[model samples]
Target: MTGSIVFDPLIPWPAIAALAVLALAGVVLALWRGLSGWALRGLAALVLLGALAGPAYQVEDRTPLTDIVVMLEDESASQALSDRPDQMTEAAEALAVEIGARANTELRRVTVPDGAGDAGTELMTALTAALAEEPRARIAGIIALSDGQVHDIERAPDLPAPMHLLLTGREDDWDRRLIVRNAPAFAIIGEPVTLTLRIEDSGAVPATGATAPLEISVDGGEAQSFDVPIGQDIDLPLTLPHGGRNVIQFTVPEAEGELTDRNNTALIQMNGVRDRLRVLLVSGEPHPGGRTWRNLLKSDSSVDLVHFTILRPPEKQDGVPVGELSLIAFPTRELFLEKIDDFDLIIFDRYKRRGILPAIYLDNVANYVDKGGAVLIAAGPDFASADSIYRSPLARILPAEPSARVIEDKYRPSVTDLGERHPVTSDLGDGETWGSWLRQIDVTAGAGSVLMSGVEDRPLLILDRVEEGRVALLASDHAWLWNRGYEGGGPQLELLRRLAHWMMKEPELEEEALWAEATGQTMRIIRRSLSEEIGPVTVMRPDGVTLEIELEEVSPGRFEALYDGPEIGLYRLAEGEHEAVIGLGPAAPREFEQTIATGEVLDPVLATMRGGVVRLEDGLPDLRDVREGRPAAGRGWIGLTPRDAYETRDVTQSPLLPAWLVLLLASVLIVGGWLREGRR
Candidate 1:
């Protein structure tokens, strides 16, 4: 219990001072006149002044709170690496037991986890939260059990008590990591894309050879190995093979004496697209469809179309000299032999061998189509004549042969039975009200799938895949009349565009293929088919675990499912042999790459607090009472703060005496004494 005095007053001090002065005057007059009751009069005046000044005692009771101890534990991803998880688990348990055992103190345990993305462990944020829960005056000290790495140090709260850290890790631990810095998200196909990467050493890297073998692979193909120097950034240039998403995996063979291999391998997913598609359009004769092909190819920003038209054939000189004609010669040799390979696609629109293109030039064109080149042929009436280009060396690659019979019946070109499911023409169904072609071709045989049919259901459009190349043949050249609003042509532009893309070896045209569309990190995996249903989808996570999920029919002949990834890393989905990579998170989390727990990461700041100490081996220290500014340990640690408080039950208060009676008696006495003293 504790005691203290408090004051309460009624009358002002000025009234009391006036009463004292009157009593002093009476005393002086009585002394001179020798009055009998002089002392009693003075005593009465003093009592009156004291009574006007009322006073009372005020009291209160309080119990001061005890100081609090804060224990912060790092529970981030990095702390979970190596044996750090176990180490932290043990140290936290020991520290809790010690602080709990202390007297006059309360222990507050705080757990901090790794922040999102590059933000590592938010230790300071955790500390601030713990501090807010306790009283500032009652806070004694703070203890942290974590690796030294803290992401939010700038946000650390101003702690009332001294803060200390108990780090967890061995001194000899070391790590090596591969870092990919400036990797492009999208790279052009067949063009070398440069990626900046570095192999870095941390902690106790060995003093062995500096160069290591780095094996890099794309889309899980056989990797190529290279010797790269450690601790320096290197530019790696790689040319992608196909378009769409590509996964590049780089790994270094783990060194024998290396500390950890978690950082040895890294995966980067980049998208591939073509810079431009070069196409050569060889028009045999001027026709309405010839302009349609040129317009469609020229419309795209990424397509470079080179169109050649033979306006006047060499045989059409008709008694006029060849030099006199205005038509320029078609450079067949320069186009077919010289720069044939440079073009991605070669189109022959109603082209025929009318002594204009020799058999040798036509043979060279066939070779071009055989050697991994795209070829498209839009045939006209000349296909039935002896001048048909199909009769030349190109006849072997053509899917259909001319029957020498012209079928001149108006028929609505419709997709074939198999074409209804084919990627090139599947979306276009019969009875779609498409324009009718004025002319039709009579074809006897074709090696490719019949995509479109003419009069009496004859094959009008056929698509085929040859050795390392692709071919599409449109038997009728008059199809372009539909584009001129002849008979309400339905999606003429779309049909021709898809036909061209199909001949370019687009992956979407593959009969059996697996592909996925990305929505952020989640993927909508789709398996398209002409069949009734797709079998099943098998997904492979970055951790090598595979999941087989049944797909649901979302639309006609299209199966789809959503796959949500658990982490931000590369994931693969495969249906049979079809697979694609889904990148969920950043290629690397800049922070928390090193997961070892160490006190060195947290010890420097802890040492700044004089009263703080780390006793990991000894467990939590015993609580004891110590003077302010003294060592935190030595005697038992105090658990509760001592509060000296007391309570008062009753209070007595009153005025000293009556003021009117004292004033009247003092005035009469002073006047009578003064008269007697003056006569004397």
Candidate 2:
């Protein structure tokens, strides 16, 4: 309850000012004429003005609002290190108790957890949200208990009152971080690429260890170790061993007295791309399909196509000398014996032996495939003849054996039951209205997967792995009809491209493989196999926890499971003999980027509000109220502003003097002044 003098004016302020001037002029005239009535007249005028002013004693029924103090507790990943969580909890509870016990004060406790992906500690973001939910006038102070490793400082709200930071973690806390300053997303195969990195030590460094052991691993292989100097940048020159994604993990052994070793490891994902894809395309006899292969390889800017057409065979006997015949003799010796390994893929299209390539040269091709090389055989009718290339030494790697029969029936190609799961032909368009093929070399399917079949269910396409290498066989030569838009064409381009890439050992089309991809906290686990159904996948989390999840069939031979990752680190997935390693978030998450706790970032913010930055290590500071812009903190103490906000429920107003009393005073003064003037 409060009482004060207030006015409900009976006359307008402008009117009152005019009346006062006339009264003052009258009194001054009377005084100048030496009349005693001047004093009496002035007193009467004062009473009249007072009555018109409507003065009244007002009493208000007020309810004081409780001042709200927000105590935001940081529970992010960084705060969970060592004993920081315990320290934060203690400080937060103390803050709550202090604020609650204070007269007419309330505590709004807010717990902040880790943010999504690399968002790190969103302390300010959480504070802003809490402030929005409460009244600004009721906010007396904001107190945050954290490790002071905040990531979203720019989002700090405009403090309506004093703000203080009670820092967590001990003064002796230390950490070692592995930093990757620069890493490319793609690198040329066999060419050395430069990667920039460094090692950093924060807080208290180990006295005995000046350097740390660093391990570098690529594609889950054996790791190579080297001692890396602390606080120094390193430029490492390395060559990629294979094509496709190469996941390189760099880790520094944790030193003694470190806060956490999470930041001591970094994962870099880079793609290994060939400078150029060298391909050797040999065509024995010219046909319409020959142009298809030429146009396909030539269209790709990355592929180097070396095409050769044998215009004349040894038994042709055209009565022409070898020198007069054609474009220089086929460099068989240079191609087969000298530099055979230079090419990435070797395609023999409609090739017939006909004594063109000797037995020794064919043996070299087989050996090449045995040494991690790729070969593709596009067989024509000649494949079923006595002069077929199947009669050569290279036949050992062929996925299909010739049956000496050539079928001349019209049949549209269709994907086999097993092809429904194979990546190459699984999603290929239905062949209901596809074009028909005229000729197909009949053969017995060998130890390989049949991706495409023709009339009577004969193998049309076969893919197999030949000891350290890959091989593919296509039985029909009339697939170019699909390219010519016969019966509305088909997915010939896609089919051929996948077949070529699969033979080249593309990782995506591997028959038996496990891999995972991450988007934020969720990971998509993909398992590719030839089996009908796969068992549950066993996932080994970065925190050494194992989880088993069942997979559902998404496509032919492709099984997938969606799992949510709880932490930011590398996850290992295994099913049978297949295993995969995937990093869910950044190589070094933002939470662990600066593990050592300090008050440097928030000190300026606290100073703006005249609040102190106190470390909870010594002790939880005492809470008190201080004037705005004054020192808000002192030794062992913090401060909150006293808002003294209130709500008024009632108001009353009444004239100080009645209208009749003012009239009587004015009448008596008028009578006395008239008498005095009359006497003068």
What's the TM for model 2?
A: 0.93
Q: Tens digit of lDDT per residue, candidate 2, span 442-519?
A: 999877889899979999999988998889999989888889998788888888888888877777878788888878
Report the lDDT tens digits of candidate 1 across residue range 475-575. Answer: 88876776787766677788888888777766766655677766555778888776776678888787888889899977556788887776555677777
- Report the Cα RMSD per candidate: 6.5, 2.5
The ten-residue window of minimal lDDT in model 1 covers 638-647
lDDT scores in order: 0.73, 0.86
Q: Rate residue 206 of model 1 by lDDT.
A: 65
lDDT of 1 at 191: 92
lDDT of 2: 0.86
Residue pairs in steric clash, candidate 2?
A: 421-556, 421-557
Q: What's the TM-score of each model vs. the native?
A: 0.77, 0.93
